[model samples]
Structure formats: structure tokens, C-alpha cells
Target: MNIVYWALVFFGTFFFMEFMAWFTHKYIMHGFLWHLHRDHHNKDHDSWFERNDAFFIFYAIVSIVCFYLWSYEDVWFCLPIGLGILAYGIAYFVVHDIFIHQRFKMFRNANNWYARGIRRAHKIHHKHLGKEDGENFGMLIVPFKYFQK
Candidate 1:
């Protein structure tokens, strides 16, 4: 039963990050913190990075804290939680940065229906360069309409 509980915690945290990402992207990033996120929508700078990348640092800290709690504080569940968050972070980076945005130039050939939908939804989200009137704020889970064939 320990393994089952571990899996539950890991997968549960992974899925929950989607909702958390969506919520933060919609309310926080697109809300009062637009100064940090606006560069993502409208790239007025020529650097390889944006202020938006700071958001990833926040989650990285959370995951690292969870790992610390698991190791030093002896919180067993924290291990799975940290791993789940780490996994989700990696997935978000791969899909959003590499595949959709072509940041690293890989996964360019992943043009399946689901991949197309992800790109389409992201394109729509990027269409609005402002904080207001933005849609499709989630990463892994986008609207089903985008998946239409």
C-alpha cells in the first residue's frame, strides 16, 4: 500500500499543478504581476530570456522545498509531491518552450492532432499581447475545441 500511496501523491500533485498553473496564469500572471509576465506576451527585448521565466523559479523553489522537507524533515509524502512538481515542470518546459515556442528547436515534427491543438491553443493565447482578454491559460490541458479535427 505504500507504493500505491506514493503513486497517488505523485500523480495527484502532477495533475493539481495544471489547475494551479491555469489559476496563476489567468489571475496572478495576467493580473497584478503583469509587469513580470508582459514580456512573455510582447517581446520588446532582444535577450534570449524574458521576465516571464521568473515564474519557473517560483515552482522550482517549491519543489526544492518539498524535497528538503522529505529528506531533512522526514516527511515521506513530500518526496512524491516534489517529484510530481518536478515532472510537471519538465513537461511544461518541453511542451511550451521546446515544442510550441520552438525555443530549443526540437519537437518541431510533432504535428499530431494533439500537438496541433496545443500549438493552436497557444497561438490563440499569444494573439493577445495584453493582460486583458486572454484565453487558454492552462498548459497541459487546453480547451477541447482546439483538438477538433
Candidate 2:
């Protein structure tokens, strides 16, 4: 059942990314490295990108390293782990950037309560233009309070 084990690992990585994202957002992004993440909270004109995007590069490097381990070093589990990280990255981009921030001008009319809740929670997080007092750091899994009518 190696295939099944790898599949479970992949899915586990997907869920694990939520915690990683939250921790990185709350601690790393909102912590001393806020300079890199500052523009995400406050806009930098119509630049269409933020220094915050560098966080994606960091994760990309992690995935790339995992791929290198899988291919060159024969660390077999790294393949599924890398794919899982990539998948989570895609989902985070779609949810946080596309759906919540409307960066690409899509998903504006997603009227479902879950969609609404995601938007609401992200809005709360963005309400703090400074790094000090942000909340709702998670993406796909948001607070139940946001889901209430």
C-alpha cells in the first residue's frame, strides 16, 4: 500500500500547509519580517504586486528542494510532498489573491456563504494596515464566526 501511504501523506501535507500558512502569516509576516509583508497590509499604489509575493518564492524554493531530493537523491516521499506543497500553494493563491483580494478580477460574484465567510474573515485581517494586531490568518479554514449570518 505504498501508493495509498503516499496519497495520505500528500493530503496530510495539504492540511499541514494551513497551519504553516497561519504561523508564517502571524509570526513571520507580521513579525520582524514585516518589511517584506508590509505592502500586503497597506497598498503601494497600483503596482499590481507586493513584496509580499516573495513569500511565494520562498515556498517555491522549498518545493524545488523537495523535487531535487526526490529526483536526484531518490528521496521518494519528497515527490508527493513537493506536489502537495505546490497544490496548497495553488489553492492559497486562488483563495487569498484571486477570490479574496480580487487581484485578477475574477470570483467577485461568488455568493455562497462559505465564500462570503472567507471574504469577511480576510477583510478583518486586512483591517489592520499595521503588522501588530491582525487576525484570521488561515485561508481555506476560516473562523466559524465569519460564517454566521
TM-score on alpha carbons, each prediction? 0.98, 0.96
Taking the tens digit of each residue's C-alpha lDDT, what string does model 1 give over 78-146?
999999999999999999998988889898888789999999999999999988998945799988899
Off by over 4 Å in 2: none
Model 2, range 1-149, lDDT digits (tens) per residue?
99998999899999999999999998899998999999988877688889999999999999999999999999999999999999999999999899988889999888999998998898888888997888845899987999976
lDDT of 1 at 107: 89
Off by over 4 Å in 1: none
RMSD to the true structure for each prediction, in A, is 0.8, 1.0
Model 2 whole-model lDDT (C-alpha atoms): 0.91
Evaluate residue 53 in candidate 1 and report its C-alpha lDDT on the 0 to 100 scale.
Answer: 98
In terms of lDDT, the poorest run of 10 residues in model 2 is 129-138
